[model samples]
Target: MTDVLLGIDQNVDRAVTQAETMLDLFDATDLDANLLHDFVDNPEGASVKQVDSVKRARDILEDAGAAVTLREGSGDPAQSILDMAEQLDVDLICIAGRKRSPAGKALFGSVSQSVILNAERPVLTCGSPGDEA
Candidate 1:
């Protein structure tokens, strides 16, 4: 089956728009990534919100009828995202965020930018629900 990697982070709260898009765009195995801990740990209580975010996003995706496997990544967010994509050798990658102007992109380097620049596979970027083209 085709494999698709979805790179998610704290911005995941805004990923619904992109996730839904992917649902219609591809018929593939979906892999989700959350670089919550540099080292694996039990995600409980209130210590790690990132883990919680991943779980919530995973639930959302699953509820939407997309079967997603959450992958745990370590180290830099950008590197981890690429590493997971490479390791899984996914056919495509999907990430979501608000559209940024050129100046905004230059002011802050984004994970999506880094992945789009470096990943050998195709990358699908999704913007906010009401974002203009």
Candidate 2:
């Protein structure tokens, strides 16, 4: 069965919104929420960290009927998501994207940009929830 792995990032609110939105995009297909824990725990450097909000987000997704998958990773966010995609042979990746201007993004490239650029398989990027104005 073709699996749609929703590559989750640290942003809890975003991840929850993404998962809820993805529920529509992946109706018949099997969907799994692969939450990137180490990324949340160690964004800048390797120091054991814990955040309750992230754990709560994972539980929220699970309660929403999302099959959750957790794993540790150390690298760029784009690389982490891509590695899982390749390893699982995922058909598509559902990620979050911000509606940033070219100049704004040039100053800081978002994870969505990196994933879309390097992913071997097709990527589906959902816009930020806050930008629905």
Candidate 3:
């Protein structure tokens, strides 16, 4: 049983793409995926199930026969993902990487980069559909 923590953002395309990539990369029957959505600004107290990206990802993974669980987090997105990964003891942490300029990243910070740098376990990043190399 391989456990995976799939960090889903608001990008529906990226989330679905990552889910499809996972199905192609692993045996769905042997995979257990936790779909996580972090509400960075949760004044309204949003739930993970309320996020379209997480819900779509869950549907794709579950349809492929992967055991799927929904998780919610509030705070820094990268930190939340790392904390959940540690708590779940997942074998892999998967996230979507969006292309950002160096200056943009310097100012805004990159969640994928932070998770990759700080994670104790392996982190797999899937680029968005039209991202260039």
The model with the greater TM-score, 1 or 2, is 2
TM-score of each: 0.69, 0.73, 0.96
Candidate number that wins on lDDT, 1 or 2: 2
Arrange candidates by TM-score, descending. Answer: 3, 2, 1
Backbone clash count, each prediction separately: 0, 0, 0
Per-residue alpha-carbon lDDT of candidate 3 for residues 1-133, written as tens digits (9 for 90 to 100): 9999999999999999889989998999999999989988989877888888988999999988999999998889999999999999999999999988898899999999999999999999998768642
lDDT of the candidates, in the order given: 0.63, 0.66, 0.92
List pairs with backbone clashes in candidate 2. Answer: none
Any runs in candidate 3 off by more than 4 Å, and if so which? 131-133
Residues 1-133, candidate 1: write the lDDT tens digits. Answer: 5577776655555555556666677542443333222222335533334455566666666776566776666556667778877887777877765577887878876767888899998988877656532
Whose lDDT is greatest here? 3
Clashing pairs in 1: none
The positional error of residue 59 in candidate 2, measured at the CA in angstroms, is 2.8
Better of 1 and 3 by TM-score: 3
Residues forming the 10-long window of minimal summed lDDT in candidate 3: 124-133
Top candidate by TM-score: 3
